[model samples]
Target: MSTAQPDEGTDRATPDALLHTRTGTEVTPEDVVLAAGRDVTPKNLEWAKRKIETEGVAALDKLLP
Candidate 1:
């Protein structure tokens, strides 16, 4: 995952707006949820976590690539 520093004139930096990979593509929490095959909701993070734990980083190949 990547971190973003707020640009000039921005009020705040949002983690959800940061890119999660080196390609510089922006990703939202909703993108993460959908990537993990779940609904666009906060609870989907849990599903993503479980998938990672069970399948390893390779599980995210489709999403990240």
Candidate 2:
């Protein structure tokens, strides 16, 4: 007789999980704008830049996590 084990090699991602994977780490201004539900325009990019400058790492954390 042989025992079969569950397969853990392949991973599955839910829609919510996909959002995190797509973003990953290494925050970008475009990411910030999108996370904040804003369009990726030049003005939004500049705003995101200032946000990153002021908040640093916390910016992405606040937006994502």
In order, what is each prediction's RMSD in angstroms? Answer: 13.1, 7.5
Residue-level lDDT for 49 in candidate 2:
97
Query: What TM-score, to 2 decimals, does candidate 1 have?
Result: 0.37
- Candidate 2 has an lDDT of 0.80
The residue-by-residue lDDT of candidate 2 on 9-60, one tens digit each, is 5566556534542344677899889988999999999999999999986687
Candidate no. 2 TM-score:
0.58
Candidate 1 lDDT over 17-48, as tens digits, reads 46444344544445556775677665787767
Q: List the residue pairs that clash in candidate 1.
A: none
User: lDDT for model 1, on a 0 to 1 scale?
Assistant: 0.60
- State every prediction's TM-score relative to the real structure: 0.37, 0.58
Worst 10 residues of 2 by lDDT: 15-24
Q: C-alpha displacement of 46 in model 1, angstroms?
A: 0.4
Off by over 4 Å in 1: 1-32, 36-40, 62-65
- After superposition of all CA atoms, the RMSD between model 1 and the true structure is 13.1
Q: Residue 22: error of model 1 in Å?
A: 7.9
Rate residue 59 of model 2 by lDDT. 81
Model 2: pairs clashing at backbone N, Cα or C within 3 Å: none
